[model samples]
Target: MRILFFDTKTYDKESFEKQTGNYPAIEIDYLKTDLTPKTATLAKGYDAVCAFVSSDVGSDTMDALHEAGVKLVLMRCAGFNNVDLEKAAAYGIKVMRVPGYSPEAVAEHAMALALTANRRIHKAYVKVRENDFSLGGLMGMNFYQKTAGIVGTGKIGAAMAKICRGFGMKVIAYDVYQNPELADFVEYVTLDELLASSDLISLHCPLMDNTYHLINRETIAKMKDGVILVNTSRGGLVKTDDLIEGIRARKFFGVGLDVYEEETKNVFEDRSDEILEHSTTARLLSFPNVMITSHQGFFTEEALAAICKTTLDNAVAFEKGERNGNEVEERQ
Candidate 1:
C-alpha cells in the first residue's frame, strides 16, 4: 500500500518504521508538513495517510485527500479531535484512530502533575537549584480526603479516578456519555455540581465543539475557592485566558497543565529555543501557581510502543478491507 505519513520528524521514524513490519514492503512517503489541505494534495497517489493528533483533517483537508484518491486515514493518536469525521465519511474516505492505546501513560502523567503541583515540587526544586531553599512559601496540602472532580470516564479518566480514590480523596466525575462502571465507583454529578464542589478538577475529555472551552470563565466562577485545575487532554478544552484570570483572582490555588489552547505548532514537540512571544502563555508561565508541562502525557516507552502497534494495525486493517469501529463515524 502507498502511504503518506505527514507532520513527521526524524525522532518518530525509528519507532514507527520498526513497527510497520515487512508485509508487502509497504510503500511509505514521509512528509515534514502537517496534513493540511494544501499538503493533502501531495498525497495524490497514496492509498492511505497516517496523521498525528495535531495534523489538520478539517473539511478542506479531507476533501483534498478524497480528491487525491486517499481511501483511509490511520490516526496514530487515540484522540480524533483534529479530524473531520463526517466529511471523511461522506467522501467515502474512512477514518480510524487508536482507541485506548496508552490510558495508563496519560493517567500516570495526570497523577504526576497533580502531585507535583499540590506538593509545590517544581517550586521547591527551582529554589534548591538556586540554593535559596529555606522551606518558605513551599508548604503544601496533603492529597488525602481532597475532593477530585474527574471529567470524562473513559480509560484514562477511570484510571485517574482510581488513583485519586486510592489516596483517600472523594472522586466526583462528569461525563456526557456516562459510563456505568465508573459511575458505580465515584459520585457522578452535573457539570455545575462538579465544578462547585471539587477541590481538584482534572480534564480528560476530547476537544470538540461541545467540549471546546468547556472550562471557561463562567465555569471557573462556579468552582470552589482556590481549586486546583489539571488538564492532560486537548489544549482547547480549557480557555487559557480564563484560566489565567482565575489564577490571578486566586479562584484557583494551583494549575497543572500539559496542554493549552492555541497550541497548533507547539504541543507534543519542542521549539524551546524559539521565542514564544505569546502573551497569554508568557503571562501564565510567570505565575507561581501555574505549572506548565510540555504535552508529554503519552511520552512513556510503553505508550510509544502501543501507539506504534495500533497505528500499523490500522494500516493492516485497511489492507484487509475491514472496518475499525474506533474510527470517527460522524461529527456535527
Candidate 2:
C-alpha cells in the first residue's frame, strides 16, 4: 500500500514514522504541498491520501484523486468543512477524520488568547521592547467572580468550563447535544440566557448549517454590553461584519480569534511583508481590543503527534478493510 501525505509539517514527521512503522507493509510519502486540484495529480497510484487543515478537496480535486486511484482521504483535524463531501461521495472517496484528538490543546489556547486580549499582554510585550514601561490605558477586568457562557459543551467546551471554574468564575454552557459529565456545576441553558448573562462568551461548536454565522445581529443584540467573545473553533461560526460592528459599538469589549472566516487561501503560512487585501481581516487587526491568531489551536507538540498517529492509523486501517471509528461521522 502506498500512502501519500499532503501538507506535511515538520512536527508531524516523527509521529507519522513511528505509527506507520507498525504497519511495515505500507509505504508513506510525505509532502508539504496542500491537496488542491493541481496538487491532487501527485497522488497517482496511491491507495490513500492523508491531509491536514487548509487543504482544499473540492469536486475537481476529488475527481483528480479518484482518477489517480486514491480511494480514501484521511483528515488529521476534526473539522471536514474544508472538504467537499458530496463530491467525495460521488467519486467513491471514503473520508476519515480524527474527531477529538486533543480538546485540551484548543481549550488551553482559547484561555491564552482571551487572557492576552483582556489584559493587553500583546501590547505590553511590544511596549517593553520599545522601553516604554508606563501602564496607561492598560486596565482590565477581573476574571474571577465573572460568568462565562460556553456555547458548545463538547470535550473542548467542557475543558474551557473547568478552567473558568478554577478561576472562581461561574460556568454556563449551551450545546445541541447534552453532556452528562458537566451536569454538576454547569447549567445547560438557552442561547438567549447565555448571551444575556455571560460576561465572557466563548464558542466551541463545529461549523454546520445551524451554527454558521450564529453570532450575527440578532444574537449579538441579546448579549450584554461589554461582553468579550472568543472563537477558537471554526471561523464560519461568527459573522465578521457583525463582530466588527459589535466592537465599534463597544458591545463587544474584546475578541480573541484563532480562526478567521476568510483565512483558507491565506493564513497558517506567511504574508509578513505583503499588503493584506482582506478588508474584514485588515479592519479586525486594526482594533486595539481584538486579537487574531492563525488557526493554531492544534499546533502543540502533543496534539501534532496524536494527529499523525491517528491519521496514519486511519489510513492503515482502511487499507486493511478494518472498521475505523475515526471515519464514523455521517457524511454530508
Candidate 3:
C-alpha cells in the first residue's frame, strides 16, 4: 500500500515517520507540496494519499486523484470540511479521518488562548522584553464565578467544560446533541441564552452549512458587553468581518482565535516576509485585543502520535477490505 503524504511539515514528517515502522505493509512518501488539482497528479503510483486540515480536496482535486489511480483519501486530522466528500464518493474513492485524537490537547489550548488573551499576556511579554513594564493597561477580570458558554459538547467541548469547572466557573453549553456526562455540573441552554448570559464563550463546533458563519453580526449583537470570545474549532464557524465589527464596537473584552475564516492562506506558513496588502489576517493582527494563533490547537505530541496511528490503521483497514469506523462518506 503506497501512500503519498502531502503538505508535509517537519513536525508532520517526524510524527508520521516515527509511527511508520509499526505499519510495515504501508509505505509512505512525503511531499511538501499541498494536495491541489495540480499536485494531485503526484499520487499516480500511490494507492492512497494522506492530507492534513489545510490541504485542498475539492472537486477538481478529487477528479485528478481518481485519474491518478488513488483509491483512498486519508485525512490525518479530524475535520473533513476541506474534502469534497460527494466528489470523492462519485469517483469511487474512500475517505477516512482521525476523529478525536487527543481531545484534551485542543481543549487545553482553548483555555490557554482564553487566559492569554484575557490577561493580555502577549502584550505583557513584549513590554517586559522592552523593559517597559509599567502595567498601564494589563487589567484583567477573574474567571472564577463567571459563566462559561461552550458552543459544542463533543469530546473537546466536554473537556473544556471540565476545565471551566475547575476554574470555579458556571458552565453552560448549547449543542443540538448534549453529552450525558455533563449532566451533573454543566447546564444546557439555548444558543440565545448562552450568548446573552456567558461572560466567556468558546466555540468548538464543526463547520457545516448550518454552522457556517455561526458567529456573525446578529449573533455578536446578542452577546453580553465586554464578553471574551475564543474559537479553537473550524475557521468558517466565525465570520471574520463581523468579528472585526464586534471588536471595533467594544463588544469583546478580548478575542482568541486558533482558527479564522481567512486562515487557509496563512496556516502553518510564515508570511512574515510577504506583503499582506489586502489580508484580513493583517487587519485582525492590528488590534491589540485580538490574539490569533496558527491552527495548532491539535499539535500536541499525543495528538500527533494518535493521528499517525489512526491514519495507518485506516489505510490498513481499507487495504484489507474492512471498516475501522473512521470511513467518511458523502452522507457523513
Clashing residue pair totals per candidate (backbone < 3 A): 0, 0, 0
The TM-scores, one per candidate, come to: 0.94, 0.96, 0.99
Q: Write the per-residue lDDT of candidate 3 for residues 1-332, one digit (tens) a residue.
A: 99999999999899988989989898999999999999999999999999988999999999999999999999998999999999988889999999889999999999999998899999999999999979877888999999999999999999999999999999999999989999999999999999999999999999899999999999999999999999999989999999999999999999999999888888899888999888998888888888899988998999999998999999999999998899988875
Leading candidate by TM-score: 3
Worst 10 residues of 1 by lDDT: 19-28
Off by over 4 Å in 1: none
lDDT of 2 by residue, 177-274 (tens): 88888888898899999999999999999898899999998899999998889999999999989888888988877889999788886656787778
After the best TM-score superposition of candidate 1, give how far the Cα of residue 132 lies from its true spot, in angstroms. 1.6
Candidate 3 steric clashes: 0
RMSD of each: 1.8, 1.5, 0.8
> Which residue pairs collide, candidate 1?
none
**Candidate 1 lDDT by residue in tens digits, 103-174:** 888988998888888788899999999999698877778789889999998989988998888899999999
Best by lDDT: 3
TM-score of 2: 0.96
Q: What is the lDDT of residue 297 in candidate 2?
A: 89
Could you arrange the candidates by lDDT from highest to lowest? 3, 2, 1
- Deviation from native of the Cα of residue 286 in model 1, angstroms: 1.0
Superposition error at 237 for model 2 (Å): 0.4
